[model samples]
Target: MTRRWPVVLVGPMGAGKTTVARLLADEWGVPARDTDHDVESLEGRSVADIFVDSGEAHFRELERQAVAAALADHEGVLALGGGAVLDESTRALLADHHVVFLRVGLSDAVKRVGLGSSRPLLLGNVRSRIKTLLDERSAIYESVATLVVDTDGRTPGDVAGEIGKALGERA
Candidate 1:
């Protein structure tokens, strides 16, 4: 039987969504795309620079467009930007797709990002900022995700295996 082969990965910036998505795509012999990379390519600027100059609304717009394009142009694993779920249009798209939410604790997220990564929302007061962002975004992720995987101390391969198992079951 033919199988529906699209997996959308959504989570916080440092939650290893991209890593896991790539692994899953490789394991499944499908394509992998990251929404942020798509945005940067289309906009001709880094996401950090866009946020620096035009504010988050502009970056979010680019992010939304990137997501729509990725969904339309690719048919495998897609890892969305951290704030992608905040956009209503993206959430609507996710509703019809298999979405996975990688849930990672604040401390682990902070450690993974390591006060680097040029993450705008995560700048200064890392712990509290992340906690607040998580509080705001967790519900949206939960609402859209068909499966939720906690990524604490888990390698990308392990996470991919979990997703593979879940995908097989769903099939």
Candidate 2:
């Protein structure tokens, strides 16, 4: 039988989805699955390396698979990759779950994620890419979000607590 989770966290690179998902899952006493980590585990390589080797198209396909498997096999807090929503299939899969859009402003995101690092997407023009991603993906995030939480100035604990409270209310 298939099982669904209570909350799925979706947002951009610096949105703290991975950390917050852990906090939420710890509070709920369940597992926290991050699709990027799952993909890394499955592929035996980092996402950046995968992109460098196989390219974004291949990475997206892998991400789709990882997201599908996690949604099917894991019954806990799940955090999707920032671009996971770019795939319509992934968006469709998220429609039935308790999806939380963890939003962060560009300045905060730049502060959190920085203009450097192994992030494949923002490798070139970090600021421009981040802005473009925010412009393009914001609506998709909003459309699929059952709840939206602005992560600006909030600690991960505070965000998790708010999510937990919202989950209680949702229940």
Candidate 3:
């Protein structure tokens, strides 16, 4: 059965996409799926493990495919890996979809993300790394988003409620 389209969430790491997506899934009366989780399960390894074992290029290829397939097949709330928006094709697919950007600042992301974690990209000088990433990808996220939700200093439920209100308005 074709369920309602997945409410796609995209943002920087630690921006609460996963948490907000779960909450939105409930509000939308549909399921939630994270493309990162899908990739992990498919490879039977953590994303960090994938990077360690296969390398960044390989992991990105896998992430690209997983995001592409999920965008095509998932009929629920879908949270993408932070870097997923880098792919032009994936960004193209997001057009006309209820794509919510969980926007968060570097300070907020630092607080939520913490230092020394599994995030492969934030491996060195967490602050500088995050800043660099934001510089690189922030514009892309804004460009692809249908609705932008600031996740700083907000509960997942609060963001979800805001999105629910937005979705209600859309309907």
Candidate 4:
């Protein structure tokens, strides 16, 4: 059987989606695409800058477009921005693909991101913000995921390997 083209990774910020996507793409001999990076390339700025300049609604629209284009065009491991799944259309688009949700706990996420991170959403009280995001998005991530991988204490390589193994089993 032919393997799936894009193995999409979705999770909260600091869940290592981007890192694992690169590792998985390398292991699988394909390229890796990140929606956030796509947006940055198109806008000529960082995600934080986009959020600050145009506000979240504008950034989200750009993100939505980036995701749709990537889903349709790219054949690789794709990592989505943490809140991409919040858009219903994006979630619908993901229904047919292999979606992996990288699950990380509060403490782990805080440690991974650090308090001084430039992520727009985690502006103040980074720990509290992460917890809030996790609490709000966990169920949605699970609902859309074909596979859920706990990343609390795992390295990117290990997570990628597990995802590769799981996808292989599914195939």
Instruction: Tell me the lDDT of candidate 4.
Output: 0.93
lDDT of prediction 2: 0.90
Q: List model 4 lDDT by residue over 29-108, tens digit each.
A: 88999999999999999999999999999999999999999999889899999999999999999997999999999999
Candidate 2 regions off by >4 Å? 1-6, 169-171
Between candidates 3 and 4, the TM-score winner: 4
lDDT by residue (1-171, candidate 2, tens digit) is: 122474799999899999999998888888898999999999999999999999999999999999998888788899999999989998898888989999999988888998775698888888888889999999999999998999999999999998888777322
State every prediction's TM-score relative to the real structure: 0.93, 0.94, 0.93, 0.97
**Residues 43-147, model 3: lDDT tens digits:** 999999998889988988898999889888888899999998898888888995788898998999998989876688888799889989988888899999888
- The number of the candidate with the highest lDDT is 4
Candidate 4 colliding pairs: none
* Model 2 deviation from native, Cα RMSD in Å: 2.7
Instruction: Write the residue-wise lDDT of candidate 1 on 1-171 in tens digits.
Output: 223556899998789999998888887778899999988888788888889989999999989888988877788899999999999888887777889999988888888988655677767777778889888999889999999999989888888898888877433
Q: How far in Å is the alpha carbon of 45 misplaced in model 4?
A: 0.7
> If candidate 3 were superposed on the true structure by all CA atoms, what would the RMSD be?
2.6
Candidate 4 Cα deviation (angstroms), residue 133: 0.3
Ranking by lDDT: 4, 2, 3, 1
Worst ten-residue run, lDDT, model 2? 1-10
Stronger candidate by TM-score (2 vs 3): 2
